[model samples]
Target: MPYTTSPVLPPGTLRRSPQPVLATGDGLVLRPWRIEDAPAVHAAFQDPLMHQWHLMASGSEAEAVGWVERWLTEWEGERIAQWTVADAHSGQLLGRVALRDIVLADGLAKIGYWTTAAARGRGVAVRATATLTRWAFDAIGFHRLELLHAGANEASCRVATKAGFALEGVKRSAFHHPDGWHDMHLHARVHGE
Candidate 1:
């Protein structure tokens, strides 16, 4: 069967350009990554959990700078929109979130996020994810958004659940981590879901 656009939009619509900031109130905001964020980003990537699930580890400030540069290029190309999740009160870097693999003509995208060790268990990832999820649906006109995490990542699975994404089952041997191929727990929320 052929795929079709949702009733809300015509067959070929591009996503809206990402805004400068997505404020989550109570002192957290999702903003564009800055060159100056390289150091903080480098440190966060050093966390043991980050390397466990994220696969790649930044070996130096230069590698972190390259990370930020890639995101800048992604934004320019409209393939991804990455944001620095930060504290509004202290401007501390909490983590990162992104809407990647956006297929605008089909009105769907994927969401990914992680939080610093200090911000873990504090709902920063959940709130940032929720904010981006709403923006992707309501403002960007996406019909569906997905969040997939390694099955071993209980913390991220919890975040996806808390952010209201319904568990859609696992994809066996779906991702390659440092350890080996791992199953991925896929979760999703459609428009109005």
Candidate 2:
């Protein structure tokens, strides 16, 4: 239970769930992470913008492998649902998307995403966000979804809006990165919205 005014959640509010591979009609494929993807994931993290915004960088294949292992642990612990965004036909890694901070009892989750340098400006993040948002709402019956990004991240702001999440407002100094504290923009989409 969320210990809030929200309705009591049904039984099985928290349990291990399968990370099924979801495919879109086009070429997008959302699937679980694998160790072999370490090099590619490492390459993507080499992007300066990704490292700056996320405050996470994989300098070695081992570190990237560890990152995937941690994500698998988070999934097994039922705390986060993450997927490696790839091309369905080509199977090339494009990015990653996640529904983290999952409060299943309250039917709410927050989304985060990043795209590889080659995939940016090509609608990859927007499409991935929309697909996951639809899955969260339709398949899981989640009532609300949120997207948050540093206020200075114009690209993320655009992706949030394109995914049908309205800009809620800014949270002052909500994130602390190596650079400094950053203001964050909060965007949200309700079930009926």
Candidate 3:
């Protein structure tokens, strides 16, 4: 989908944008990524469990910094929204989830997420995704949210299901992963449905 941006706002005027940080259930919080999060994100990417479920491209510290920079830029423009999941009590970074490829005209977006090995099995991704989806639909007025996972990544498929996303279908060669083209299971949730 083609990207679109909202009109610029006047100085000192309330722009009515979505909140940058959201607190999730129990002990987790979802918020925008900060530059200081670079090291933690780099460490999370190195987790073997994370690598097993998600594709990770080799990169140096400079590349990771660049990635965060891009995310910040996108968030500033309201083109894409990403949230870093962290422990509500301690404020430790756990993972990240993003609502990207947004089409404001259609009220649609694609959701993507990943968690560090330490945060697995605690329902962090599921809670964060569900909370984010609700925020998107309610605050942003999005009507539909889609999640696509590699067919082989059963864990991610399970997360989508648990988050109330219905399995839409499986598309052959839907994504190009690090290994090669792979089949993907598409899932979606619609507002008030």
Candidate 4:
């Protein structure tokens, strides 16, 4: 096969740069996860909503430490970028957001997020999502960003919509939850859109 096109982004695009600390005008900061956040990470994962929507869970503080460590290490590979969404001034853990499953050749990645119980209803998830989306598109030059959620997760759907990601379609029986398989909503936004 003849290769003609260059990668949308060169390799090391992320690995070579320090993960940034982005601020949401609404007072949230999306920064790289730290080892000290393990306690909060452990508690956040215990939230029933987190368990319901996401598969990964931190059963103990030790496991949370491992999760935090893994999130940091993944940066070296530049495949996934995770951030701890915190209060800008106090640095209280508000939530988390990430650009996952990155494919630099295609300038694409999947965005995922969750808010702590206290952060819910405060626009934390929406602000974090929008902030990350802008950074992924404008700063990282990703051509497209996708946000998928279990079809029944109306909250996530709302976050995607508010963050400017259009609903592309649904994939039936696409995601397997602890209870059973669930439909998945595929929402996306192109760089200029």
Candidate 5:
């Protein structure tokens, strides 16, 4: 069955312009990633808390550089809008946030984030996620944004809730970890809701 609806955001919406830098209003900013951030990225991956959930190992700065390069291209491709969450004045890296798996026609994307150990207890994830959510809805015209995290990730759940994402339900065995499959909590926020 062919259902008809206009593309929610339209083509070239993201590709037409350079990615933007956004402020969290609490001394944090979300900006585009750069190659110079490789050292910080490598350090973030080495943190036990970050490694536990993301399971990505940036053993060398070179690998982190590749990740940054891919993120840069992903913006031009309109697939993902990744940002570096940083201190506004010092420009120190605090965390990372992104709208991944963006679908222009559907106007939907998945929210993802993680914070460095020093930024964890200070609500960096929540602010960055909320800041990105606002931009995705108001600036880019995304109709809906979803945030999914392992059911065991209480910190992420708190971030989602604080960012105004309502818990929709769980996806059983939705994601794979090194140990086994795990249930994922699905949270979402729709434009105007």
Candidate 6:
């Protein structure tokens, strides 16, 4: 499909332009990334499983902090919107969910997420993905949402299916994994008009 431009936000916003903290099910909360969360984010990124599955970059504590800082700047500048997934009760960081390539005019966006190994298989990704999809369609007025996963990642594919995204077919060599280019399964959900 088509990628749309980012949304434009009003002035003087320190947090995400359209700041929203969403709670998914009972255990997970989706909110904007915070600078203080760098340590937890750094530790999560160090996990080889996360690096392999999510294709995340390796970084130090300082680098993690910088990454969050840059994300904040991008959010404020209306470049990308990101959310940090955390435990609702214990307030522990779980992972992250983001609506990237957001184009307000087209009312479309893409969903991407990953949870820490400790939080896997607990429906964290599914719940968070569903929550974000709902928020995007309802609150943000998005008309469509898309998710893509490496063909080898069955768990990610399951999350998309569970969240009501229809399998849109596979794209050959759609993603450049660390090993090489891999085919990706594309999934999508359109808001009820």
The clash count for each model shown is: 0, 0, 0, 0, 0, 0
Q: What is the lDDT of candidate 6?
A: 0.82
Per-candidate TM-scores read 0.91, 0.92, 0.86, 0.97, 0.97, 0.88
lDDT against true structure, model 1:
0.87
Give the range where candidate 4 is weakest over 10 consecutive residues by summed lDDT. 1-10
Candidate 5 residue 147 Cα shift, in angstroms, is 0.2
What would the TM-score be for candidate 1 when compared with the true structure? 0.91
Clashing pairs in 5: none
lDDT of 1 by residue, 1-193 (tens): 7657444444334324444688997679999998999999999999998889897799999999999988876775656789999999899999999988876666778999988999998899999999999887887678899999999899989999999999999999999998999999999999987
List per-prediction Cα lDDT, in the order shown: 0.87, 0.86, 0.81, 0.92, 0.92, 0.82
- Native-to-model Cα distance after best TM-score fit, residue 38 in candidate 6, in Å: 0.5
- Rank the candidate models, highest TM-score first: 4, 5, 2, 1, 6, 3
**Tens digit of lDDT per residue, candidate 3, span 58-110?**
36666777778777767645547788899999889889999888666567789
Candidate 5 regions exceeding 4 Å error are 1-3
Instruction: List, residue by residue over 1-193, the lDDT tens digit for candidate 5.
Output: 7758788988899989989999989899999999999899999889887766886889899999999999888988888889999999999999899999999999999999999888888999999998999999999899999999999989999999999999999999999977688899999999998
Q: Let me know the TM-score candidate 3 reaches against the reference structure.
A: 0.86
Q: lDDT of model 3 at residue 73?
A: 66
Query: Which residue pairs in candidate 6 have backbone atoms (N, alpha carbon, C) closer than 3 angstroms, thus clashing?
Result: none
User: Local error of candidate 1 at 155, Å?
Assistant: 0.7
- Give the per-residue lDDT of model 4 (tens digit) for 152-188: 9998999999999999999999999987999999999
Give per-residue lDDT, candidate 4, residue 11: 94
How many angstroms is residue 74 displaced in model 5 relative to the true structure, after the best TM-score fit?
A: 0.7
